[model samples]
Target chain A: MKLVNSTLAALRAVRVNKLRSALTMLGIVLGVSSVTVMMAVGGGASQRIQTEMRNLGANTIVLNSGALKSAGVSKGQGSRPSVTLADAQAIENEVPAVTATSPQHNFAGMQLIYGNANWSTLVTGTTPEYLTIRNWAVSRGRAFDREDVIQGSKVVVLGRTVAEQLFGNQSPVGQEIRVNRVPMTVIGELAAKGQSLAGVDTDDTAVIPISTALNRVVGRNPANPRAISGVIIKVRDGANMASAFSDIRQVVRERHGLLPAQEDDFHLINLTEVMRAKEDSARALGILLAAIASVSLLVGGIGIMNIMLVSVTERIREIGLRLAVGARRSDILGQFLVEATILSLIGGIAGVVLGLGGAVAVERYADLGVVLNGQLSLVAMAFAAGVGIFFGFYPAWKASLLQPVEALRSD
Target chain B: MALVAVSDLTKTYMLGQTAVPALRGISLAIDRGEFVAVMGSSGSGKSTLMNLLGCLDAPSSGTYHLAGQDVLRLSSNKLAAVRNTSVGFVFQQFNLLARATALENVELPMVYAGIGWRERTRRAREVLAQVGLSDREHHRPSQLSGGQQQRVAIARALVNQPLLLLADEPTGALDSVTSDEIMATLVRLNEGGLTVIVVTHDAEVARYARRVIHFKDGRVVSDDLNQNIRAAA
Candidate 1:
């Protein structure tokens, strides 16, 4: 009953000064909304990174041909064709930790032509195990078999986006599409994988047999027909990836004949390491935005203090009157404190609603992904409540400390 | 026993190292059911005396026994208790909460006393009716006339059924006509057996009281019963 009276009295006080109270609450509203939106944006970015990491297979490792060195400084990554089919095959044969390895080669800027339509896209050539390594599913028809890979048959699997570009809405599963003047039958279509972290469309590519890419297509350095660009390895479910990576590296070093002092001519890209770096930066950005938002809340709290001080001064006579009429000192304190808390709580509730709307707006109009976190919104509201209490204390104390005689005597 | 008893009650204030004596060694006692008028000009310390008597301020020295209990040594909480249940005060400005209705203003003291809502409202309405403003219970202080506002203040002061109603210049802000009406209300309340103390500089206002105490420089100069008392008419 006491709480109800205080709340009603506080609400009536707020209602008496409608515009002033709204202006005071405005600061809190902006502060809480900013905190919420910042948290959602940060959380959304981190969530997107997690999804991107998942897109890159968790246990898969990429073995790229190492950089070429001219003088002391080395050339950039994938500078040479140091990785080859022999190294990949040796790792698959020698490494006990190895589950499956797929040697991948790519032919970029290839014109895929149908009867009346033509589109430019990249074509990758790999074994059937590449499908399993990359978690690539064929949405339609069947993938090329080992027979096709071994014989270098002209069979292709179009990605969803590439297929759409070449065949429009039509299902081109048995259609013969010419790949740079060479006719290849479309045996399958890969499911849409969306854009990568680097904003590149992963679906804008087609797949074919390795032998078909290295032998039938533009054979680079005919003497090095067995050369491959990279190797994709998928560790078994229960196997440790660290041991598997080391095992693959040891096998490759021996195949390349690298001495103890000589650096291996290949690089291993652990998917998690690359993503951890990205996630760390994302987390740093999140903290920075949260700090900025907290500063805004502090400013909002100051606004509340400013208004409360004015209120205390303006209501000195009223305070004296209450004090004279049997109100204890604590009663005056409770009244003002409850008023401040109510202002902040109202602002916080409105902010949560506004923040959710802001997050959705950012996701839609701003083309950013936002993850609405229920727990985070509640924390923001709790912070607002804390702001109210912290800022409202001083003015209430001053009011409670007023001598009833002097206060009644105030003009 | 006297309802209010004091001995050498003194209050001294410090104005930046200057010892300002608002009240000196002076004491007085008033029996229950007495309508007393305190007359003093500015700087005469009548306001300070009223503040002490109302339990809003404690005396700096000396003893104050209210209703046969030592009140000077009581803690602030105990003082608040005395103020809540024993003494009710009306201010010169009719200091009702500007935003609250006249009914709410009257109920304010009961609210602090932790009274239940139904009873508080019922009693507040009863007091408003007693003050002859039953129809204007919902009017804010601004909406009411000066006399009406003072009546509301009186209703608030009387709602607690205090042993004494202390009024400081209760009619200072009113015209002669409204002042007569407010004085009549106080006379009627006193006739009902509630002790009433009015602080005023106006002789016309003081004539309504059964006894008048004149003070100068914090010392009581005269205390006497009125032989020719002016009725509320």
Candidate 2:
């Protein structure tokens, strides 16, 4: 009952000064709204990164052939194809944490032909484990098997984009297509994978057996006939990835017969680590935005304090009368504190409404994704109320400390 | 036994580094149901005495017993409770919250006393009827006449059923006619067995009291029964 009375009295006081109250609340409104927007934008960016990481495949690492140095001159990655199919097999057999490995040799700008439709795209020569390491699914027919690799079959699996261009609406499975003027049979068509984090079309390339590419299409490198491009390693779930990464590096280094002083001839890329770094930066940006927004909220709290001080001064006689009539010191303090809290709480609610609207507008017109977090909105409101209490205390204390006799004597 | 008893009540306020005595070694007693008037010019310390008696302020050196409780020795919170339940005060300014309705003003004391809303409203309305402002319960102070506002304040003072009603210059701001009307209400309430004390400088206002005490320089000069009591006429 006491709380109800204080609240009612506070609401009446607010009603008495409508315009002033609204202006004071405007600060809190802007503060909370901006906080809401920043949190939502941050959430959206984090979610987008999560989706990109899923598409890139989880718990996987890329082992790229590093620079090959000779005569004090260096050729860039994959130049001399130092990575071989035997190195991939050795890593899979040597590292217990490594579950699967897919060795690949990529030939870009290969012309794919079906009937009169000819489209230029990258052709990847990889083993069957590539499908598992890359999380790629075949939407039609079947994938090339170990038998196809061992026999060096002239068969290919078309990516969605290549399939669309070469076959249009018709299923390309069981059909024959030509890669770089070499005839190959279409064994399967891959499911569509959307754009990568770099905005490259992931479904715009074809896959073939690495043995077929080395023997028939691209031909072998004269220096190392068994040379392959690079290897994709999938680590077992729940195993320590860092340890697995170092273990693979050791295996590769030992196989290359390199000395301890020699620079590593291979480089490792942890896909999740790269994505997490981006996530951390996005989170940092969000914190910075929220910090900036809270400065406005601080200003709003100061405004509440200023108005409450003025109110206390203006109501001296009323305070005296209350004190005279037997109100406890806590009663007077509670009255003003409640008034301030009500003001900011209303402002916080208004801000939530405005901010949600702003988030929708950003999503629509600004082309940004937003995920509204219920917990975050609640925290914003709690913070607003806290701000009110912190700033309202001094003025309320002053009012409560007034002596009844002196207060009653005041005009 | 006296309802209010005080001995050697002295209040000294600090003015810079010097002490200014508002009350100097005053002793007084008033029995229950007595209608007494304290007469004094400005700065004579009658107001300070009333504040001490009403438990609004503690005396610097004094022993005060309201009923049986030691008013001077109680904590500030207890003092507020005594003021709420034992002494009702009315100021010359009416002191009604300008924004509150007459009913709400009367309910203020009960609100502090932690009464339920239904009982507080019922009792407030009863006292408003007693003060002849029952029909104006919904009117704010700004909407009411001065006399009507004072009646609302009186209703507020009466709502808590205090042991004593202390009115400091209750008619100081009213015209002669409204003054007599207010005095008549006090006279009728006193006849009903309520203890009433009015502090004022006006002789006409004192004429309604059964006993009158005069003060000069923070000391009482005379205490006598009124031979020509006005009888609220």
Candidate 3:
């Protein structure tokens, strides 16, 4: 039989039970739509995280002093010795692979006073290299220079949030603000940095040179004078990060006088490793969503098969009439297969539209980065059509194999 | 030469391992352009024999030649081809597709024969006109009267111009007046050189045929020329 004729006949058959056909196709629509929407949302979240990670400086590495409780009782159970200015200088001088190094000393709940106005904020003390390692660019004013650090000048750089809170629209550059009863001149304002996924406010802190912060503002404790919170390092190139990390570890152990068998009291956090972990978690989440959506597709396929079987049973007499008119088994098969495929194709088209609409709405209204990728939509559509073919075959085959005489005899 | 030759044709059913014979060694020959009727009471195997001759079922054991081709030797595809091009069937229930118009129902066989839509439609209209259904071509089976539906079935059967027309109790569901109308249509086609076979228990319906074959207990008890009946008709 001509394919066009058979397809028309199949269409006529489906049209006879319009409500039933639509109900059957509803399952496929839901299945494909859910798959598309979930993929969009999941893919969007991973892309957002990657963008944040890139903005945080791809080559940056964080080093923190590990607690000495597990090392031995003689070392005392207090916070481990901080990474110092000398240690930062040693890494910069001895490690050729190290591009820049900065020691960070953070003080929380610090009150900043500017004449009659005072606001509480976080205070961070570091060298000029801190801006490069952290990927922060000065937005409004110039950053503090090495001259300010050497002279132990009481100078500071305000983050966007701190500047806005204290000075409003007025420029705070070269203006003096007091910190813990010590006055300091603001030399720059950091750029506007958004909050991280971990909910940390990046633009609510103040940056000051480490020398002035330790000696002039927050005086170093007599028991731990040379103490610093942690060290931030930037590598010349990522290709040599592993080698540079081992060299830095050796130098730190030697300077601290730790034996070969002793466990190092410092922890290194490679940003590259953190980025990879985030990517792996995102990938796992995507797979889980895909798997759950696939269950809906499976259920939809089964629904199609079930409805097709009922259709076959209901149309036995019609099948008999066609067979009597000289229809081959393949002709019957083609007719039913065409009906099934049309149902799935219609459902797939509807799903694509609905899924894209859903993604766009969520992205706009909920502030998510959801986006419908074209390739994924195509794959989902193809999979839905394949499901129709796979599940539609058995019922169609059963209809084709029916004996004409017996079918005609059926009431 | 005979258009249909059947010898020692037997068919049996196995109902849970009990062999029940429907037909036992039935031999018959039908010449081209002949109008023959097979008459029997219920359970007399007349319908079984009709089903075999119509190519709707295969005999358990038999050598049946249709148009000089060994019907038993044909493959399923060949058999389907033979059924498509060589045989037309009319059933008691009219068997017209309920969803199709009268013209579309008649065009169905040509669709199976791989005819193009234009030619199928043309031939279907011509046949519908021949059966006096030209004005009702657009009507579905449910919209037509019993007699009209039967005529549509006859038009469908004749669309392929088959070598034989097999009618099984074709008028069983119609009233006497409608039955007469349907029989007259069949008689006119048979007179126009189409071989016709009618299987029925109605003696009055059998009178229209040129010959009569009677069956009892799965075997033919009498086969005779109906000269008186034919002369009267």
DockQ in order: 0.58, 0.50, 0.46
Task: Kindly list the per-residue Cα lDDT of model 2 for residues A1-411, writing each as its tens digit.
Answer: 677878887898889778867876776787778778777887877777777777767888898878778898987777666788899999999999999999998889989988899999989998999987777899999999999999999999999999999999999999998898899999999999866656678999999998988888877777777787789989998889999999999999999998999888887888778888987987887777677666766676566556656656777777778888998887887787788888878988998888899889998998777888757767876777676666665655775676788777665
- Candidate 1, residues A284-315: lDDT per residue as tens digits? 98899779877877786677667656766777
Q: Give the alpha-carbon lDDT of every model.
A: 0.85, 0.86, 0.83
- Scanning candidate 1 chain A in windows of ten residues, the lowest lDDT window is A217-226
Candidate 1 DockQ vs. native = 0.58
Best by TM-score: 1
TM-score of each: 0.85, 0.72, 0.77
In TM-score terms, candidate 1 sits at 0.85
Model 3 regions more than 4 Å off: A11-17, A63-87, A94-97, A103-131, A134-195, A199-230, A235-280, A352-383, A398-403, B175-177, B225-233
lDDT of each residue in B65-139, candidate 3, tens digit only = 999999889877787787788999999999988878999999988988999889999999999999898899899
Tens-place lDDT digits, model 3, residues A170-225: 99898999987889889899998866656677888899988888887666745568
Better of 2 and 3 by DockQ: 2
* Model 2 stretches astray by more than 4 angstroms: A1-99, A104-125, A136-230, A234-319, A328-403, A407-411, B1-3, B31-39, B67-69, B74-78, B171-184, B187-193, B201-212, B222-233
Clashes of each: 0, 0, 0
Please give the interface root mean square deviation for model 1, in Å: 1.4
Residue B216 of model 3: what lDDT? Answer: 93
lDDT of 1 by residue, B1-233 (tens): 99999989999999998999989887899999999999999899998999999988778998888899898778777777788889989889898888789999999999988898899999999999999999998999999999999999999999999999999999999999999999999999999999999999999999999999999998999999988799887
Interface RMSD of 2: 1.3
Superposed on the true interface residues, model 3 gives a C-alpha RMSD in angstroms of 1.6
